[model samples]
Target chain A: MIKARVTVTLKNGVLDPQGKAIEGALGSLGFEDVGQVRQGKVFDLELDSADPGTAKQQITAMCEKLLANTVIEDYAVELL
Target chain B: MIKARVTVTLKNGVLDPQGKAIEGALGSLGFEDVGQVRQGKVFDLELDSADPGTAKQQITAMCEKLLANTVIEDYAVELL
Candidate 1:
């Protein structure tokens, strides 16, 4: 099986309060040196076929269909 | 300089409504096969040194200071 790793991130134009909140939390946690933080997600999909073409198609479909918000987020996929 | 890659994820106990919302959105987007969706973040930091030990200390500080929400998120880092 192919393992597909997907990451979805908020678009630059979108507001990320969660990220902001985390940034605040980190500062309180003794990481006084941290300046900024961006947040997103990672998805690991185990597929049946190892074919790159088919996997890419399936993974892209997964991202477009559910992994990423094309409206507010951007997505990229990596295969392993 | 060293490079650090950081990822922040909501703790399993926390409510990831954003992730849930994304899951529902994906279903509406025609990816009927996706089952569950979880969201997180990634950070790429350019550091002043390439040493692994120092880089790790710096990166960990970055995480504690600004990367992960120790309250609702867990974080891990990698060098790149």
Candidate 2:
């Protein structure tokens, strides 16, 4: 089995209201030094595939098809 | 400015309905050999502090106080 980690993050210049809210909350909680707080998603997947090369390609396809919204988000997959 | 990345994931044995849904979706989409899928959160933060040590401490506090639910989720902070 192969293990993979995928990170999906908003594109630069995209407005992230959730992240903004968190930043505000952090400030209210007395964490003043925090500047930009951008929130993203992470997925840890276990694949039954044997080859790492094929696994990465398959995972990338998964991202493009369902895991990520390619319109506004970017995804990166790391095999572990 | 110091940059840090924080990842928050559900603890083992915790029920993740969303992850389960994604797993099922993958199966339906013909992505066979996919085993377990777990979902998590990632935060990219830019701190105004110049010291990495202090920045990590502050970010950790942010995770403990607001970013993660200690009862169900575990968080890791990395300075980048």
Candidate 3:
């Protein structure tokens, strides 16, 4: 089996409310040093296929279609 | 500024409904090769501090206190 780790994060210039909330929470907790916090998504996928190349291709398609909103987010895939 | 990337994932054996939902979605979409899909959270933090060591220490504390549910999730911190 092949394992793929995908990280989907918002592109620069996008406003992230969750991240802003986190930053506010941190500041309230006295972690004033924290500047900006951007929250993202991670997916660890286990594939039945053994070929890394095919797994990557399929997973990339999966990200494009459903896992990530390509209009505002970018995804990176790592084969493990 | 220092950037700290924190990845929070569910512990082994924990049931992830969101992940399961994604799996089902993939299967319905004809990606039958995908077996297990685990969803997690990623935090991209920008800190005012220049020292990596201090930034890591603070970020670790953040993870323990608020970023992660230590009982069911494991978090890793990377200073970049």
Q: Per-residue lDDT for A1-80 in model 1, tens only? A: 66666877788768878767766776676555555455677865555664878878877987776566799989888876
Model 2 interface RMSD, in angstroms?
A: 0.5
What i-RMS does each candidate reach, in Å?
3.8, 0.5, 0.5
Ranking of all candidate structures by their DockQ, best first: 2, 3, 1
Reference-based lDDT, each prediction: 0.71, 0.96, 0.96
Candidate 1, B53: how far from true, in Å? Answer: 1.1
Q: What digit string (tens of lDDT, one per residue) describes model 2 on residues B1-80?
A: 99999999999999999999999999999999899999999999999999999999999899999999999999999999
Question: Considering summed lDDT, which 10 consecutive residues are worst modelled in model 1 chain A?
Answer: A29-38
The collision pairs in model 3 are: none
Flag the better candidate by TM-score, 1 or 3. Answer: 3
**TM-score of every candidate:** 0.65, 0.99, 0.98
Flag regions of model 3 displaced more than 4 Å.
Answer: none
Write model 3 residue lDDT over A1-80, tens digit each, in one string. 99989999999999999999999999999999999999999999999998888999999999999999999999999998
